[model samples]
Target: MNKLSDEKPNTSGVLSAAARDARMTFGDKAKDQLKEAIEIVNATAKGLGISVGSTATAMLDIHSVAFGSGSISLHDETGIPLRGMGTGSKRLLTAGLHKEASKSKSIALIDEIETGLEPHRIVRFLKSLGSKDAEPTMQVFATSHSPIALQELSFNQVFIVRHDKPGGKTSVLAAPSDAQGALRATSSSFLAKSVLVCEGKTEIGFVRGIDLFRVEVRDKESVDAAGVSLLDCDGGSETRPFERAASFQALGYRVAVFIDNDRPIPEAEATAFVERGGALFHWAEGQSIEDAIICSATGSIVLAILEAAERLNPDDFDLLDSKIKSASGGKLNFEDAKSFAEMDCLSSEQKAWIAKAAGGKKGWFKDIGRMEALAREVVGPRFEDFDEPFKKVLKSIIMWATR
Candidate 1:
């Protein structure tokens, strides 16, 4: 593999003796070729989302020819030197120069290709790397940590680097291209060995919270150490979970679906997922994550969560009583409130209201940042107070991830 790094662009030495000869002889063909080369560089830079001044020029001076004065200097749109341009622009210009100089049968390796580039520019840069009509076919291997770069790549072009913890062996696994279209928003998950497809943001927070707690208090490894990534699937959509799970499964990566019990996976899909060696983790039937947490967690843990919520959003809590009364038509104590909300007697609206109150924007469990802190400080030390089913869920996730 030929590595093409974005080192300092040496414009002076690039002016060859042949060009000086052509200039001295006043040969039309060589001058035309030089002009064509300059045009190609400018065009390629434009395609890579770089703005270059039209004043960019390469002139051969007869008097200073022996001193290597026949050189090219690039400028930005405002006629400023390329050296004075932003890093992203300079990198793009350097890339353009490399592409112009490349042969037909070339394999280019670029490290951190997305560095100093804006997210939107990443797509254009990728497109410019491919072979176009009349251009030589080339292969490009680029490394990037940008999600935008991942989104622009087809799954077949993507590989997840898996490092075995015990053996310290690293392997690269290719992702299938079938899910490329649907994965634009969730492409970052492809980097991990195993993915936990969460139903929504709240579920993401809870899982991350638990992970933080374990790492800080229990002196355990973080989820990242287990090669697990959590993806929020924007909840309540029945097909999204299955689609995402299938995407990862096609890539030969271990995947687990973590959804609310209230959202059931169709039997056929569930069976197919299991048949294909995927794992599924969900709450108890008829319960969302909030319900499960409330019903299963120890009373002290529940009180702590509530008290923490109150502390975080005092004004929101002040309005909670009136809102609860309007939704439930009666005042209920915190101990019985969640259970009552979970019962079959409540209407859909009432259930939604309860859900909002439990995990909405201003709800106790809604702030992922605070939840992370809580997990580290409070939940981590008292993790045993979490209900058995919740504990089982955590264990299952860890087991699946490590395996």
Candidate 2:
């Protein structure tokens, strides 16, 4: 059995040692036999596109074999020395050597298998590490930070390592077979102790904002300190959120989902999720996070949102005013802004417009750091004054994360 590393090998010393060992075994005929064997090996290696020093002239005094090429060198694809080979080529060669050297009882440990390797080649590299039809039953353990690698492996073969900040602890969770695709799509979530599978960028921004507010204004721990990760699912696709949540749950993570009530979830799926002890947080019926915020927040918070919107997009004010007037059925007045329901019946377009105005893709929420800063200012000390529904949803997420 032999151990091979991706690190560059000392080719000259390795070949010299092999030559010395052959001399001890074969005695008088060793030199001729060793030279012949070297020529054959070099030719075969070259034919297979592998680089090897081509000559084996005897140098018994120094106990070394001289190469016909003058210096011992492993040539690359274009015939450059191994010393000049790129990282990918080096890694590929190292992996090949390890696979060839492995035996039935061998255990191979690799770090960052995706390093310097193209995404397309990762699958082939993994397959070569072991095979059911081969005599050498090799067992391999590898670490990777690439989603491409995850796509090549099943959930059961992948493990999530999560670090807990509060208690300073770490734990590993195995991925569930069913959520392989979702896990691969958002592989970074596996690094968090708790996961918040958000519907979209808006929800992600809102939660991050609240987490900032809690830390700066309320003097409470932030979500990051609690080891909670927020995963944006692009948007609340019919099955994306559920699939992601299920994948996290399968890994023994305390998973919570935050979505708008505008989209309906299948009853069977919802029941199964609850039965599995997953927490689901949704906005009010037919409402989104934007709608709930505007409807449930106090007069000051609503005013702040409007102010933020005006700063974000000055030209959209007239359009917003017209929409508000149409929804309110009259001129905008302080008295009419009592509740979300009373303010206006918001359409999806209106919700999107308001969200954009208050800092959607191009606004303060565009940069997570900026969003956290804005949240600190907008949220202020009156954290409890935030809309009840939004507050409740956030509370549920925080509770699950802390637990």
The local distance difference test score of each candidate is 0.67, 0.63
Which runs in model 2 stand beyond 4 Å of their true positions? 1-92, 100-107, 111-139, 144-148, 151-174, 236-239, 314-374, 387-389
Per-residue lDDT of model 2, residues 249-277, tens digit only: 87787788887776676667767777898
lDDT value, candidate 1, whole model: 0.67
Which model scores highest in lDDT? Answer: 1
Error of 1 at 286 (Å): 2.0
Which pairs clash (backbone N, Cα, C closer than 3 Å) in model 1?
A: none
Separate clash counts for every candidate: 0, 1
Per-residue CA lDDT of model 1 for 284-317, tens digit only, reads 7877766666556554565555566566666775
RMSD of 2: 11.4
Off by over 4 Å in 1: 1-36, 43-54, 59-91, 94-112, 115-120, 130-145, 154-178, 333-363, 370-378
Error of 1 at 326 (Å): 4.6
